[model samples]
Target chain A: MLFGLLETGFVYFYWGNLLMILLGGGLIFLGIAKKMEPLLLIPIGFGIILVNLPLGGLMDYRYELTAQRSGVVQEIVIDETTRFAEGTAIVRTNAEILQSPVHGRLTSIEVQPGQNVGAGDVVAVIITTMQTDQSVIPTEPIGLLSRLFAYGIMWHILPPLIFLSLGALTNFAPMLANPRVMLLGAATQFGVYFAFFISLFFGFSFEEAASIGIIGGAEGPTTIFVTATLAPHIIGATAVACYSYMAMVPLILPPVINLLTTKKERQIYMKPKLRPVSKLEKILFPIVGAIIVILLVPSSAPLIGCFMVGNLFRECGVVDRLAETAQTSFVDILTIFITLTIGGTMAAENFITVSTLSILVIGVISFASAAAAGVLFAKFMNLFLKEKINPMIGAAGVSAVPMAARVVHVMGQKENKKNYLLMHAMGPNVAAAIGAAIAGGVFVGVLG
Target chain B: MSKEIATPMAGKVVSILVNEGDTIQEDDEILLLEAMKMETTVYATDGGKVKKINIKSGDRIEEDDIVMILE
Candidate 1:
């Protein structure tokens, strides 16, 4: 019997693996053909394909050692210098194992081939191997994607870097011009709590429920950050849901906005003029904003703090080189790694479950509820204010950035050609970024 | 008093939209400034005739640096 031939991955392949490969190709098609978030979708789609290939071992950790025998009383060799007594049990920490020499020096032998050791008992001791530089010299082969993910994401480094890049690219002029529009931003977070409760009703723990609720915020990095902390198992589904919804903002938000606001309200024209934000205000925004938000939600400091630092680099006008790197090169590189890891996390075994379907459905509901809440809140505010705010601008408060704001502008244009709502819509659009970050922080603070 | 049209941020002057001595209204774009891949139109704060153009296209201007003089 040729055992090696029978042990090939082809014998282990199943229908679910084929389905995941097709789904990955479909995402790639959507990214390339539909022009939807190509930067994220393409890498994630390819990662999905890479991880789903049976025997590819892209997601497996290669350094783990398993017992090869069920007996005792065999000779034990420990490197070139030492030999351990038979039946001597040995234990090593994960760090120690990873740092060991490439060939994995045997530390001891607890059982020999004929010693009749039971299952799950220690049979031998081998120190897992690594090179001094830690790049896994050719002797030991670690899964490439798994290594990147473990070091980059598991250590909690990538999400904040993404936020830093976002902050560098963002312009705060619109948000600063009309601070009150932030109320709409805050109001949009109603769906976060609403979805949290709904998720709880569906039998999710408090931590998982909080993570699911953050999908309504429509901010990808924030979603990843919260999930990575509270419910890491669901980060793949939640991040995909968040980014897909964000890309579909133009399609998803309009119907909800139209359903909630009448033509009269949508036609309410907002002046295009925005007060010029002062240099001092721009410089103070990140500093003061970080202090206030962090003081309120310390758990959010990592994401918010990095964001403010990047923004300060931009607005300070002294660090143009640093800001440029953060916005362009740094962001682009980190995005590729993060999206790839997010995709890799969705192995067929983990992704095709009923829980993923439930997450997808709940995510859409959360998004719709968020859009509705924003429009309804704007209408509520109009009753008190002498100057009526166009309710459509409220729909921009979901933190999809320019897309949500652009949708509002387009809807306003449909009602009145003379209406220019882009600038006014931007006020809430930028505020939603801050609002989503704060909501994520609140969830982590309460749940974590 | 001649009002100096100052740019609010440091950037390269991409284009001078108005010629020297061109009559301009308050908030009328005087020139386009490019920074961080974004184009910000520097607007005249006071309605006046352009008396002296202190900076031209392709000039690098600092915050509060005079790009044009309005009288």
Candidate 2:
């Protein structure tokens, strides 16, 4: 049988599937045993397990085919014997209009000459795109995950909704208090471009490189948004890397922060109470921020707009109910759907490849570099400031949110108990989320 | 004179460590608040006797919401 040809999933269960399952199990173990991002990891791991069970057809897909009108089979490929290329007239009824659905051998002609066919009949035996070989393409669409992914992910619905929930959960007061940290967040995007060029040097196409580079953002929804548009083949790998690495920010960030700073710098006390952001400022932030970003990168309107809207709900105070739902139950439901769907896409065929390995390696490089860049830039900014900001807070300038900020806060406490950087680190931590969305928009504008 | 202890941010009141009429000192743990999915201990800023509890366990409190009145 041809490789990738649909068959009993168990028959094709090879080392690839086993390996992916092990990786999924490892993710689940890390989430539970190590208490690392258990909220997202458990669902993702279970999804990987569900799809890799060799339970045939979990990821199958096909093109839709339907006859438009009822009529008699007037002729069959006029001058041909049995086969025709796509767009070639293969079925002709009275008025004559039917193109061959696929560019390969016809499995069979559904109708004979003078045979009556009904409108809305399943007369079109169209096969989906030739994934491996044209010979194995399915004649009809199959599987549930493919459709959900197509509409929810590729169609760009769920990513923005997920972003909205994230926005609702975000508290922009810290970022607005120390607006300068926005610079540190922007600096981290360097990691994206760094990995982009590195990916090209390693021979990935522009689209694929763009998708892979976004893993540096350490924001899973944004990575998914950009990847589904630019290069879908690598979404699975990039997403897995994005989330797995996000969970490991504690592991990856501390080392980079340590490598670049002196122990004295870590011990520097940062004020816990940030400048109180007024309600008006909080409300205006989402509006003005969304306008500026949408104007700059119109392509990213969906993500930025949704994010700002969610934040607006939170800041407005009038929509406490909406904000409440957006951050809580709404986010939980979306996480289940989005993460499980992501895991479903991580089929062994697509994931167990050289590209996945490259993405994982490049992801770490970009992640570490992003953290280093943040710390370094903060140190640079200190040269000009009267009251110096602790540089370790700069390491929180990734979109990992409370986790990244928490890591920085914990590290600060380790160095000096009096130092409370949670509220301060939050500035760059939240800014990094906006920074990533903005950078992702720019990339999508230029490359997508 | 009575001083009010407010939460630093919005979160669910995880547990109340001090009861009304209890004497507490500065920097004492007043209660636990869960925010951003992380639990943080809310501390007393000034030593005082708890006069009244304005919030109970499991109530969602916003930033600067008075959780307790310390006398």
Candidate 3:
């Protein structure tokens, strides 16, 4: 019993795990007590605590699992863990077949010889030391969560699926009522560019700056899509920052609106009843929007295409069943995994860097700048329009979805109790989300 | 002339602010609707007397559902 106790993970415990666990606890507190994005923060907080536990092995890469008694690292011929039959020779980068010391029956695999393999369904074992007489050494992947991350998130599958769910949930009626609010959404991208330059000034690589800057729009799936492609190493930081700040939009956006607009400007109101978008117009938007955006930025095809397809499912009116499922169960299930997997990436080793902290700072700056740009642009637009806009609604273009819209609505109500701005704000709310998606596509187009 | 006011979106009727036969002004709060976990105040579209109330507090409503008729 004493010997067995000694063999447990307690011996390897360190200060980092304790600190991260506390940090994770703080996130849980914010989600529950503060009611700040509980859906995302709760799972992510729990994931952090779970991943940081000693010897949990929840985040071990597949290559780290193989025990090498004696071997030299070799170049990777096939990075993917596709099917390999028993007794089939392993191919090297140089096209030289790996010679087995014995007739080894190596079947199940998800690996690269010398490099860390991402998520895979099979075990990747390369017979590194050919003549060492260590024949047929099999390996079991230790981390439970790591495999999920590698197979799901790392595969670039979940982000588009999430976008599909988002499209299904969206109501284009708001955006279509006022097509000009769409410009406010585009205006928010100024924050993306501003943050990119700031990150670059801080000595981050061009790609890293692009990925980090996307946090401004506070579109979680888009941030994940862009970061995963550009600066994958910083995904844990960017994702967490994106969500935490998104939850704080209600708090973050109000001050910025106050700074830029006068009391008279805040009290402005628009008509409650939109022009009432026809169902035919609703059904055509996804199709037309996809064509224009994808044509302009071909690299954004996956994100925008999936989003528009999902939107089509919602607006077509024929597939109510598919639309309902996509909106509810499909989206809820994906949110659990995507948020949890993101939290799983926040292990002490990956998250506690000085650079990660900087990403957090940059996130707030980008988000604020994005909201500011939207308000400023709306003010600029007022100069030419016969009818004035409530500049506060422009802040909804930060794309925190209904949260940003609600904040704008509430702020409007405070200024004038009779004002009904929610529907009007929704126009820019949805537009901001689209603008962020397009911004992500621009990055992927030029950089990816 | 009389007109019926329908909710433009789906939500739960949180509370009704007017009693039957009460006269109201345009943009007066008739009821509060909660949708997408946010509160939305449903305002009277035009000044009229509340002739019939079709929805009570905590009733789930759909788009274009007639909630009240005003004369």
Candidate 4:
């Protein structure tokens, strides 16, 4: 059991996360010192650093029945007759008891030589206690009630309290205005549902299905919140799967993209026509879209409401302060609580085991499938259109903001130098945001 | 192949730093432009001879619009 404590640390600790923290630190250096996407990368890197710190209990343990071993320093043997005798063994069989001392550093150095031992002046001491001391210790009847109350409060009461708070922080309203983008985003979400259904065949429950479904968004906070609400049981594994895959987006997305699309398709030319969006259209889009979505799926109202509210502020033209606050200060503050709540929810008993590994696999499939769906949909649309739309821009359907759009743009330019896909792709890019929210709403409405 | 830094933003080409066939190196300032109340410089992209000078001073340009081509 001495090395058990260290093994617990080693097993629970993620070396990949540790590496990510280092990678994040490097990104921060590149952003701040080298001026590469400073506005985004710095916070992201810091977020990576804070979230990756190992907490001993992220996943559950499967305890197996085994022969009880005596403490390393002390060995006790009993005959078969004495095995059932009263006071045969102070320690129960198969009970994990920490025989070693839990050391505490001594404070107040006043040890001259060896003065008479005082009541309170015991300097350094090793507190040796059994790990199952609570079961062994005899207490009053009230103590049982208190323990029961503590367990109830800690296990059941605290989680929902944290969940509701996180739910309050998320603003899903910005997804209202760009219906086209939202459609694409929602279209892309087929990957999540597809993965969800497939995982059920592999033996995940409905709640776990719901948890795995939201991994398509690649939004950590949203992923955590959905998993926490829908499947609090598997919150740990779900969250780990969510964050790990989200971080791996740059790595994962490119490979999936490369494998699916041919080089000729990647280089498709897109002539972007710059049509200045009217302020009236921008303002009206959110209000109309929100009403439609909220009316359709009330379960997603919280996320949709907040998202539209942000967009409303952005296009309202008069409230610069409100829009700035929503996008920056409000988002920033909420992000901290969201990340912590998400991270804290991953207690070991909730996470770990075979189910988590399956969820992670399902999440990857969902993301890849969403991307493939988006590209194929774009190609299908191109078949009917007179003015050719670059099929590569179809990839911007996933609501990853500038990253997805940039990928499309980069690929388009790779095909033809005359092609400028960024602005046109932004149309679908913004639309995908709405699409994702709608899909999220549908998921919640049907399954939540 | 030699490379030319085109107009990054909509601007008017204000002054020509090098004429046709003028030799320039990478990161060398080639010409200046006036746009959005700011003066911007077009840079030579490689260590090579300027093969062509397409625009002179006072020519209008847009974002990513080719200011010059080199070989």
Best candidate, TM-score-wise? 3
Judging by DockQ against the true structure, name the best candidate. 3
Each prediction's RMSD to truth: 10.0, 8.0, 9.0, 12.7
Higher lDDT: candidate 1 or 2? 2
The fnat of each candidate, in order, is: 0.00, 0.06, 0.29, 0.00
lDDT of 1 by residue, A1-448 (tens): 5677445556445677689889889889999999888888999999888877755667653333334333443433233223222223343322122122222225345544344544345544443212112232222325676676667765568888889988998888888988889999999999888889999999988988888999999898899888877876677789889988998998899899888878888899776567789999999999999999999899889889999999999999999999999989899999999998888877676677677888888898888898889999999999999989999998899988878887887677578754557778878888888889999999989887
Tens digits of lDDT, candidate 3, B1-71? 88898775668999999999999988888888997689788777677899999999999997678999899
TM-scores for every candidate against the unseen true structure: 0.75, 0.78, 0.81, 0.59
Please identify model 2 stretches exceeding 4 Å from their true place.
A1-8, A63-141, B1-33, B40-71
Instruction: Classify candidate 4 by CAPRI docking class.
Output: incorrect
Model 1 ranges with Cα > 4 A deviation:
A1-8, A62-142, B1-71
Ranking by DockQ: 3, 2, 4, 1
- Name the DockQ score for candidate 1: 0.05
lDDT of 3 by residue, A108-221 (tens): 344456643223222334321011101233222346666666566656788989899899999988889889999998899999999999999999998889989999978999
- Local distance difference test, each candidate: 0.77, 0.79, 0.79, 0.53
Candidate 3, residue A338: how far the Cα is off, in Å = 0.7
* lDDT measured at residue A434 in model 2 versus the true structure, 0 to 100: 83
User: What overall lDDT, based on C-alpha atoms, would model 2 receive against the true structure?
Assistant: 0.79
DockQ of each: 0.05, 0.15, 0.28, 0.06
Candidate 4: TM-score?
0.59
